[model samples]
Target: MGNSKLYKGSLSTIILKLLSEADKMYGYEITQKVKELTKGELQITEGALYPALHKLEAEGVLEVEVARVDNRLRKYYKLTEKGKEETVSKLKELQDYIANMQVLFNPKFGLES
Candidate 1:
């Protein structure tokens, strides 16, 4: 529970990357996928997840489709063309950031020269 807070920052990036891999996905599906992929290291809360989804949708980076499933309305999100391009750049940016963080966190392993 305590360690969960540490993952808060990466949630958006994670969600974006996941949506990039395919066409679209639903809220519960995203949560389940993240849990399965991370082996429980990250559990996205509804509060955090929905807000990010809404923000992305509002930003026009994502397209939303509402459909009836099991007699209930389900909203699915898919990346727009812009989102596809953005995903590539965002992933590269995130990769570099993580690499730098690794070097900073493990000074002994980083190049001294």
Candidate 2:
């Protein structure tokens, strides 16, 4: 992402949100998908992607499958039942956060606080 500070906190949410929509995705696929979805505004690196995946997998929010593709073994990640529930909760949290930021930035929305 161009301004990574703004995206860092939400990286996990972004990944979860994408996996929720896609049945399964590998690390590289997730990176490319984010780039495509954001029209290249966001680019996820191996440095960032794997750690997040590993964390989610460790949490039992994601499960991994290994399969041979061409000559190489690839690992694909899919959300677990817990992950589905987490996705919904995270999405709501992110949406509310964004809306609050928007209203805070645009005074026309009239932030009471």
Of the candidates shown, which would achieve the greatest lDDT relative to the real structure?
2
For residues 19-55, what per-residue lDDT tens digits would candidate 1 score against the true structure?
9887889999999899888788777878889998898
- Estimate the TM-score for candidate 1: 0.87
TM-score of model 2 vs. true structure:
0.93
Residue 57 in candidate 1, Cα distance off native in Å? 0.6
Q: lDDT of candidate 1? A: 0.84
Candidate 2 lDDT over residue span 4-104, tens digit each: 87787898899999999999999999999999989999998899889999999999999999999999999999999999999999999998998888887
lDDT of each: 0.84, 0.92
Collision pairs in model 2: none
Candidate 1 wrong stretches, greater than 4 Å: 1-5
Evaluate residue 83 in candidate 1 and report its C-alpha lDDT on the 0 to 100 scale.
76
Error of 1 at 111 (Å): 3.1
